[model samples]
Target: METKFLVSLMFLQAIINGVNLLRPPDQHGSKCSKNGDLNSNVLLKSRDVALDELYKSFRLPFTGAQRSNNGGIWAHALCPPKEKMEECRECVKDTIDFLKKDCPKQKEGATWSIFPHFYCMVRYADHPNQGNLAEWAWVQFNAPPGPGNATAGELEKAWNNLANTIMEKATEVKNLERYGYGSVLYGPHPQNLYGTMHCAPIIYQM
Candidate 1:
């Protein structure tokens, strides 16, 4: 029974996360996407220098978590600016810890999470990978029953619109900076929603 309750809670959280899908979502893929763990790819593969630079960039300018590694890597964790940085840190830290539980071989993956704030991203890779890859990253959409007359037509339109925006913004970020998008609706109750996609901006250069 407890397990059932916990599953129910998790399902609820995922729905909310999907609804607010943060700007870029997570940089990593689903556990099934690759063959190993995210850290093995992100933390282990990256060099020390890039990680240090990333750390400094996040705290000061973004007020978020940041880090980079060799092989031209960089990352900035996501969260609401209003939340205590410590809390967001803890959440992201926990996400990393949990991410370890998955993709034991793929060596690359990320999971969206929330304790406070709408969404977040975790990224790391091999090769000379850098920049905002959000546009190239896979886009996901979700729409549930709602109070308004919004139908499948409205939901599909919203999803495509969001994808198109992500494609455009990612193209414009110059293959180095960062970019993301998101939205929320209350009047529709269970209406469809919108969110941004993300990637290593360098993906655009490719």
Candidate 2:
């Protein structure tokens, strides 16, 4: 009985560790202007206003919007699909707090966080009406564990097929929220492969 209990505990610990590894890090990437042309104090004040507006309106059920202040301070916040109003609000709040603490005096900054069933993003810049289509920066995370006996070529083919499918579905007009999530099964044991894509609303207009 003692040995069985110990084995169970070990298995539980391994599962917990795997989950922790999958969770997004507290901070991904940040940038503070090195040229020092932008005024951090003014930007900070404007950021506060923008964030407040975003937090209030973004909490509305089944709605998404962008916020900006007159002083060239703009912000965009978003929560994953199917999130409830309260869950979205809380996620945005946490994201805002994390960015403010992690990236101080940054003319432009953005952060992404992944919770159990959802993810959120917070971004701000010292420019007005900047479209989301612009590709300022990007970040990549570790991939999940692969199939136990899949060949290198087989894995590549599976990944490519998954990526193409996601892109087609995510870009379709039916995806009003500009967010898509799906999974595919492949390989001998047929392991599940999951993928998600989200595009800011501004991109659709462009």
Point to the candidate with the largest lDDT. 2
lDDT of 2 by residue, 1-206 (tens): 43223222111111111123355545333334342434666767877777767667753446433454536677777665566877777777787887787667767666666666556666776764444333332334444675456667766666556555655665689877765555666666666656555555662231
Q: Which whole-number lDDT from 0 to 100 does residue 192 have in model 2?
A: 64
Q: Residue 194 of candidate 2: its Cα lDDT?
A: 65
lDDT of 1: 0.43
The model with the greatest TM-score is 2
Stretches of candidate 1 off by over 4 Å are: 1-29, 35-58, 63-65, 70-76, 80-84, 130-144, 165-192, 196-206
TM value for model 1: 0.51
Count of residue pairs whose backbone atoms collide, per candidate = 25, 0
Candidate 1 clashes: the total is 25
